[model samples]
Target chain A: MIIEGRTWLFGDKIDTDVLAPGYAMKLSPEGLAQHCLEAVDPDFAKLVKPGDIVVAGANFGLGSSREQAAISLATLGVGAVLAKSFARIFYRNAINIGLPVVAIDLTQEVAPGDILKLDLAAGTLTRLKDGYHRELQPMPPHIIDILEAGGLMAQLKQKRGL
Target chain B: MPQTLTQKIIARACGRTTVKPGEIVTVNVDLLMGQDASGPRRWRPRLEELNAKLWDPSKVVVVSDHYVPAVDAQSAEILNISRRFARDYGVKNFFDMQGISHAIMPERGLLRPGMFVAGGDSHTPTAGAFGCYAAGFGATDTTAIAITGETWTTVPETIKVQIDGALGPEITAKDVMLWLCREMGMENSFKSVEFMGSTVSAMSMSERLVMSNMAAELGAEAGIIGVDEITIEALKATGGDYEGAEAWVADPDAHYYKTVTLDVTKLGPQVAAPHAPENTDDVGAFAAVKVDQCYIGACVGAKLEDLQMAASVLRGHRVSPDTRLLVAPATVRVTEQAAADGTLATLTAAGAILLPSGCGACAGMGAGIIAEGEVCLSTTNRNFQGRMGHKDASVYLASPYTVAASAVTGHITDPRELRTSTRNAA
Candidate 1:
């Protein structure tokens, strides 16, 4: 699978609270998406375009097991998330919800608005601006299968003939 | 092959004799728990869309705690949906407006040894105190578990934490967890944390639950403790079956990815400052920070024992005029127990306002939330930015004893110092 998008840089420990703030939890998924990253950068939801990629330092999506954190990003059409590391639940939540997330260190090399391309199957990332490339650890086959099916629910639906 | 308790539990659930770390396996879930915010309120629509029903209603437990007592129209609607989901699904173990799901699960004898559990909330590892492999999952994963009675997990390596020596007066499990959060950074993802040693063995099930609950703050997949006589006794007290509980112990030569050892003899009451649970230090380090509110609530705090800790410090003293004290028991049973034992009386006599039993204020929902620029010393687990209220508000984490002591002084104060000073004055 290939994904291309402009990059949005974030720092370490970008927790679920900022990604989907508690105050906006009661809103619809789209309304909640409007408040995504509102605490850190108030303009994130308004400024973010479809197919934009989010790159962050270690422990992205660190707190809360709310799937809305991942849904908010997906709702805003985030192409993929690349971080140095991720909290276990958030990583699973993102994948289960059909949001592609990768654990790779591109925070230091990638800057905001840098267009990048990701070949998930090949486990490689490329900065379109300068042709800078980095190898990424490939996801497991089962996880890839789920993502290809557009999430666990979709995969389950397909398997059950529902 | 020798296996850690976590591996043993997973092996049993997956019907495997052995499993290795980093291997993905789909394990049958023994029990599934969900709260108002993450469980039914979110799962209802997804389940409808999938045209699916619960795999087994008896194995599921639902609780309405997050938006209980109808704070507003939206919250009231959320609670209503949770109720409808429980009834529509034929879930017999539904707990309505009962308290936090973590504390309520054990109180009702739902958790048992060697069980593989999944909970909707992040603090689900609190069940790990019962010698189970209970880990938190997001709504989508939980929904999948609800439909199939199984979910996949990447087997996690175990990180053993051994604590020795007895806890001194006023230094409770909350302090130890705050200390652990700093000592072991909150970046330990994809790992299970197991607590062992003389100290853990001597602790009550309540204290052990606190240790496992905060494993989320440590960023661990699950926090577990080996089952012992204390665990058996607690299980019995709660009317839970404990047959074959002794078999859940880890092998003597089980391998651990890492081992951390701590001696509680010299450890002081610890505190984590604003913004992060990992930003911790000795209680004295935060002495100069005056607090506008001292809150005791959440699954990690406000248990019966936690309430007793606060009552012990507030028995004869009063909350400072400058600071307001709020105590929201974790569950209704905790409230009843505290009231029956005079713990609630002691707290209220000291000017502590009691809120309804729920995850109030701790999750930045419900009552007692602080305003911008105000400071609160809380007994809850996480204190991340804007978790308890305004983004500019500062929330500090500490034990119930320290929170109660600070409530009395209007500043961050050590519980031991207040105890000594009270004796000195007497």
Candidate 2:
């Protein structure tokens, strides 16, 4: 999928509490989508458009591995996540739920609210306004296979010819 | 290539002889877990989205202790979701508000040595207490574990923390951890830490469990207390069939990326300052700091010993009118035992409000919230900015002794002074 959005840049260790506050933990996935980043920036939910990408530094999704962090971002219409590194659980959860996560070398060249374009299949990232190009390590064949199958359950179903 | 704990565990799970750092490999999971707050939301949706029939329902465990008995409608809703999810999935291992997920998992034999356990909560690394290469992952990772029972991970290098010397009075495992948090700060990111040496050997499993459980807050993948007789006894208490459980230890010549020594004798009661668990200072340095509230609960503080400590200081005393004291047990069983022992009576008579066994104030889900400019001395983890209540409110982290003393005095007072007060009363 070709995705484009204004990048929401965050520094290292953006834990689950910031992504999905404990107070709102009771809300449905759709409800959580509306409150994403309410702790860090109140207007983040309203400001984000569909197909937008969130770029964060190392240890993104660092604290509690609640998949809600990924599901909330996904249901909020986050097109992709680009980070320097991801906590193991968050990374797996994002991909399993059909959210594309790319680990790219973060540089000072990108700033918050910078419009960027990502081609998941091509493994290419481009800052739309600045014309900056950065290539990311693409998902391997097996991971892409899992994604195309729409997660592990679907992959199993397909393998069984169901 | 040097083998790390992550490498060794992943390799065995993947059926490989060896794996290197930064190399990705998808390995099978021996156990999967989720707590009340995160499980229902993530697992139910993923289960539906995938449309897969539940595998062995017993392999999955749902715990509802974060806000058991429901703190508010939100917490209540989450609890309902967890119960409904567990029932529908036929999950026989649902721990309904029984206790902290980590504390209960071992008690139920869900954690095994040399097994790969994944949980949706950060403290899942608590399984490492039993030599399981357990670690916490985000919800998405849990979805994978729930569905495929496997995940890809990069191996981490090991860091050895050697402990020696006996603890002095008032020194406890909690003090050892807070000291590490101060010494390591956030610089401890993404490493495996193992506790070894004579001092570690002398510690009880409960004490070691406390140390390993908080390792996540330090940014480490997992913390391990080397297996010993104490571990065997703990396993036995939990009905663990130790028929084939192998004992493993770090080799005398094993490699570590870093080595830090902790002399428990030198450590004192530590307090995490406002906004950061890592911003810890010795209690004597900040004894005069006042508080508006005092809370002792969460997995860290609800231990029976913790309550006894609080009760000893609070007996025949009253709480400060300005300072509210809330004590939540970690489990219903804990509440029952304390009530039977009259610890509950002493605490309630001292004006300490007894909340149910749930996460409560630790996660700021229910009572004990402070107003703007108010400060609270708490026995929970993470004093992160605005974590306890209003962003402007301050939270000071301390042990039950400090929290109880502060509750009675309306200001933070050392437990040593409480002893003096008791002497005067006699």
DockQ of 2: 0.39
TM-score of 1: 0.99
**Tens digits of lDDT, candidate 2, B297-408:** 8777777777887898888889989788989887777788799999899999998888877777677666566677888898887765555666678888887877887888
Residues A40-112 of candidate 2 have per-residue lDDT tens digits of: 7788788888888888887777666667778889888888888877765667677777788888746366887
Highest DockQ: give the candidate number.
1
- Cα displacement (angstroms), candidate 2, residue B273, comes to 2.5
Which lDDT value does model 1 have at A154?
Answer: 92
Cα lDDT of model 2 overall? 0.76
Docking quality band of candidate 1, CAPRI definitions: high
lDDT of 1 by residue, B286-363 (tens): 999999999999999999999999998999899999999999999998999989999999999999999999988998
B-chain TM-score, candidate 1: 0.99
Window of ten residues with lowest summed lDDT in model 1 chain A: A17-26
What lDDT score is found at residue B366 in candidate 1? 78
C-alpha TM-scores of all predictions: 0.99, 0.88
Interface RMSD of predicted model 2 = 3.1
